[model samples]
Target: MSVKEQVCSLSIGIVLFPNVTQLDFTGTYEVFARLPNAQLYLLAQTLEPIRSDGGLTFLPDTTFTQAPALDVLFVPGGPGINGKMEDEKFLEFLKIQGKQARYVTAVCTGSLLLAAAGLLQGYRATTHWLSLDLLEMLGVETVAERVVIDRNRITGSGVTAGIDFGLALAAELFGDAIAQAIQLGIEYNPQPPFNSGSPQTAPAPVLARVTAASQNVQEIRRQIVQRVVTQLQTTNKLNHIYFA
Candidate 1:
C-alpha cells in the first residue's frame, strides 16, 4: 500500500470594506498567507473590486451572503469604518459571523467596527493611539499596549502593528518557531523616520497634528456609537450586553 500525504488547511476570511487601510490587511495577510496549511479569502459586501485607502484595488473572492464558514475572521480599519457601524446589514453580518468564528481579529480602527457589532463589550482592546480614548465610549477597557489579546479577539494598535499582531497570532496557532521563521523571512525589523507613534513619545507639534487630523474621525465615531447605543437600548439588548 502506498503511504498517503496528509494535508491540513485552515480557512481564513478577511473583511475588505471600502477605503480600508491597506497595511492593516496586507501586513496580516502577508504573515497568514505563508502558513503551511491555510486558505485565505478576501471577503466583502459585494464581489466587486474594493479600493484601499492607499489606492490599491483588490477583488474579493466572496461576499457576505455567500461566504463559507471561517476559522478566523479578520477586520481591517480605515475611514470607511465610519459608515459601517451604522449599516444594519453589515453590523448584522458581523454579529452572526463573529459568533461563529473561532478567532476574530481587528487591526487599527477596525476595533471600532467590532465594538459597534457588540463584540468588544467587557473585553480589553487596543487601537491606533489617536482612537484609544474612543474605545472607552463603547464601554471597552482601552489598553495602551501595542497588542491586546482578550479571549479570542486579538487587536493591534495601528497600521504597522499588524505585523506584530500577525506574528503573535501565528505563534498562537502554530508554534513560536513558525512565527520566528516567518518574521525572519519577512525581515521584520523596524526603524521609524520620526518619533510619532505615541503621545508620550511624540513631540508636542507632531501630537497636535495627529490630533487635528483625527478630529473629524473622532467626531464621526462618537455619532455612530451614540446611534448604535440607542438602537441597542431600544431593542433591549443593552441590558444583556456588556459595553466595557
Candidate 2:
C-alpha cells in the first residue's frame, strides 16, 4: 500500500509564541484543517492567549507538555522567534517533537527556530529572505525558494509563502487531487496588486526602504543567532567527545 493509503489519521501541532506572525500560522491552518481525519492543535507553553507581532491575539488549545505526538510538527516565525532562539526549554520541546513527527515543517522564519533546535542541521531549508543567512549560520544548507522539501523537512519563505507551502505539503501528504480540491475550496489564487513580495521582485527604492527599516532588528537577530550557534557548536563538540 502507498503511504497515503496507510495514513488513516493525522494529527498536526503548530507551536505558538508571543509576537508570531499570525499569517504564518493561519495560512497553513486554512489548508491543513481541511484534511480528512486530521486534528489540528494550537500548541504553546501554556494555554494563555498569545499576541502576534501585528498585535493580533490567538488562543492555543494545548500546552506543549500536554500535546500528543504529532504527525506534522509545524513552527511559524515572526518578530518573536528571536526570543525563542535563546529559549532552551522551547528548543527542547521542538527537539523532542521533531524527532517523532513524520514531517518536520516550518513557514517564514519558523525554519530558524527549527534550525536553532538542531532539527535542521542536515536539511536543505528555506526561510524569510532577511534571515536566510542567519539560518545558514545555524549550519543548515539554505535554499532561496518559495518551498523547499529536503527529505521530511519542509520549509517556506516569507509570510505569504505559507499558502504555497501549504498547498505543496498537502499534495505531498494526500496527493495532488485532494490538494487541488482544497485549493479550489479555498480559492487559492494569487494576483498581487504590487510586485513587492520579494526582494528580487521589489523596486530598488522599496527594497532599500524595507532594508533600512529592518537593519536594527536584523543586527539584533544576527547577534542572538550567533550566540545560539555558539552554544549549539559547543554542545555538539561535547557530545562528540562523550560518545567518542
Candidate 3:
C-alpha cells in the first residue's frame, strides 16, 4: 500500500543544534514536508532560534521535553556536532527517543550522534565522505554510498545528499511514485560548478587544502568521541548493575 493510503498521521521530529548545516535539514525537509499528511517539528533543547553553520537562523517548534510522539526522527550534521557529542542531556534524549522512534534518520556527520547514543554499534551506515572512517571507529560498518538504510536507521552522506536520503525514505514509507512526484516538484537537477565533490575528482591542491581545513574540526571531534565512549561505558556499567 502507498504511504498516503496507509499512514493516518505521520509526525517527523528534526533535531536542531547550533551550527547545523542548513542544506542537511532543508533538503530532507523539502521532501517530507510535501508528504500529504505529514507534520514536521524542529526539535531542540530550546524553542528559540538557532543559527546554522552558514549563518542562517531557524526557530525550532518545540524543545526536546515538549516534542510530541514522532514517527520519524531526523538528525542533521554540521560542525556543531562536535559540541553536541559531549552534551549529556542531548545524548540522553537521543538514547531515549531514538530507541522508540519508528525510523531514525541522519545526514552527514549526524550519524556520529547516533553512534554516540549507542544506536549504530555494529550497524551498517554512511556519513559525509570525509567522516566515513570515523563511523567505523565508533563500531559502525561504513558504506560509501550516498544513502544507507539498515533496518530502522537511514543515513546519508554529506550535506546535499539529504535530498536523496529523503526520497529514498519516502519510497520506504509511502511508495516510489510519491518519491518521484516530490523529486519532480523540486525540479531536482544537479549541475555542479566543478566536478570536485570527492577527493578523487578534485585537484591535488584542492584536496590538500580541504584536508588542512578540517584538521581542527577533526581534533575536536576526536575529543567528543572520547567523551561519548566514556559515557557509554558508564551506561553499560549501570545496566550491568541493574541486571545483576
Once fitted onto the true fold, the runs of candidate 1 whose alpha carbons sit more than 4 angstroms away are 1-7, 237-244
- TM-scores for all candidates: the values are 0.91, 0.98, 0.94
Winning candidate number (TM-score): 2
Model 1: per-residue Cα lDDT over 1-244, one tens digit each: 2101233577888899889999998999999988778899898999989998889998999999998888788888998898897888988888898899878889999998898888888899999887887777777899988889988889999998899999988877877898899999999988889776788999998889988987887887788778877776666565556553
Candidate 2 residue lDDT tens string, 102-193: 99999999999999999999889999999999999999999999999998999999998888888888888889999999999999888889
Which structure among the candidates has the greatest lDDT?
2
| Candidate 1 least-lDDT 10 residues | 1-10
Clashing pairs in 2: none
Model 3 residue runs over 4 Å out of place are 1-5
Model 3 C-alpha lDDT per residue in residues 1-244, reported as the tens digit of each score: 6544678789899999999999999989999989878999999999778999999999998999998878898999999998888787998888888888888889999999999888888789999988887777777899999899998899999999999999999998888998999999999888899999877789899999999999898877876677777777888899999999
Model 1, residue 160: C-alpha shift (Å): 0.9
Which ten residues in a row are the worst by lDDT in model 2? 1-10
Cα RMSD (angstroms) for every candidate in the order listed: 4.6, 0.7, 1.7
| Cα-based RMSD of candidate 3 | 1.7
lDDT of 1 at 80: 86
